[model samples]
Target: MLSYSRVILSLFAAVLLAASCSDPTGAIIPDDHSLGWGLALADAVRDSEFPAGVLFMVSCIDVNDEGDPETAIPWQFYYAEVSDSTNVLIVMVQYIGTTNHIWEDSTSIPLGALPDYADAGPWVTAARDSLGSAYSDWEEYALVVKGNEYPEFPVVLNVAVLQFMSPDTTEQLSVILDSDNDNVLGIIQY
Candidate 1:
């Protein structure tokens, strides 16, 4: 027979053990799909006094066919732009298991604010058009290929050239984030 003190101690140990078994990384939490980055971006654009805007997102779910994230890695990239060339925003979200956290950062900068870079306009345009038509919603462009040179996605052979047309002027620009083979692509207009 166990003494009362020993039984109490055992219960305390069991509680501690259960707490230790809880998820440390919080990745298992389902995406609530609440009002997050997209809505915030629209508000930001409005505050900046911009006319219309467009939001582009590319995500690579690092899950195997079994839908187990533990078996793979995850990557997400986002881009938002106003009708004018004045403001462009970017966000990147990555999962780092070693730290047991999801890492993310965002910034908004003007198009000409960055230094000069190579013009892959033609390549990107051809690639985007090759998909037939640009849909206003996110769509999967490719599937994850295991043991390939570009495991995250395929090499981006085509680039997307987005054009924001307003009554006054038409702003055309190429966003640099690209996913080759295994990336999901989609655009949201506001």
Candidate 2:
């Protein structure tokens, strides 16, 4: 038989464990384009203890094929902390249904390779508008901001839109924009 104090302690521990494992899913709004969603994502990243440094990429995954542009979906933000001249600690924040998951990996990357942090909402909207009728068919979108090798520009925003035709077929559209001014640099389909 356990003492009353021991039983109470056990109950408290069990409750804490359950609470930690439970999903906190009620906070995120269902609209990704809203400023609230962006702030919430930023808060999640800060709460997750990941480096809030420059963002390397931001991706919205599994977006609905319907024409609802405001619908929220899973999003991923990637950041890097350069530990040395040739190695970097990559931190990824994945936000899904108001829950944030943090993942870390170490890889080799050039020093001072940090990408500029930009508000991707405007750029995403611009790319969607450029798609015209095809925007409704896109299932995913991603924004990559990084320094480019091209001497003409220091950094560029590469937006990729993906559409799924079937289980085995997928098409991609790449919209390259000038990061400084959000001007369309090029568009390619693949």
Candidate 3:
């Protein structure tokens, strides 16, 4: 003996529940493109805010090269790893808006080509060759964190920022941070 309003409310609840169950996060974010190279042992120890054995990999993707000031968009990609003796938790910061953010695991993305570590000279030369003078500012960093860092639990944060593009779109990059411990090693463990 339910009223008309009660029946309608029940149906609405069931529909909402079904939708959430299908895709818990509401919308799915696209996978990032991985960089073939990971954190070097030397660089890890040098740059890591974490403990002795954390590894990190990072790269920028789908970059827009327009230099005009009026229609530029800026974005950053970040990776954070939290580990202990028993478990490891890794989070990928794909895109962050003014209030909300999206993140996933490190493995979900596919790998890109490896950067040449042996000779840093050639890599810079190649980037310059491709980019030319159309860019007002183009700087590349090696094993640096552009965002926040927490030394406790030996947390490791690796970040890259892509700035100034023609159409306003978010930028993405792949980064891995691992505790040098064998168990927590990322895809491209050093």
Q: Against the hidden reference, what TM-scores do the models get?
A: 0.25, 0.50, 0.22
RMSD of 3: 16.0
lDDT for each residue of candidate 1 in 1-190, tens digit (9 for 90 to 100): 4698899999999977876765665444333221133234334543344334343333333222222222234433233353344443433222332211121243332211111122222323433454344422223222121112223435443322232223333422222233333232433233
RMSD of each: 16.1, 7.1, 16.0
Global Cα lDDT for candidate 2: 0.49
Candidate 3: stretches off by over 4 Å = 1-38, 42-57, 60-106, 111-116, 119-121, 137-190
103: Cα error in model 2, Å: 3.3
Predictions in order: lDDT:
0.33, 0.49, 0.30
What's the residue-level lDDT of 26 in candidate 1? 41
Q: Output the number of the lDDT-best candidate.
A: 2
Per residue, candidate 3 scores C-alpha lDDT tens digits across 1-190 of 4798899999999988878655455544322211211123223332343343232333333332221111121222223342322221222223321111233444332122222222222333333343457433333223322322324324533222222232323332222232121122121211
Give me the displacement of residue 8 in model 2, in angstroms.
27
| Candidate 3 to truth, TM | 0.22
* Candidate 2 lDDT, 73-187, residue by residue in tens: 4455445554432222233333333545454555332323333333555566666667788766654554444444344444543333333232334767676666556676666
How many clashing pairs in candidate 1? 5
Clashes of 2: 0
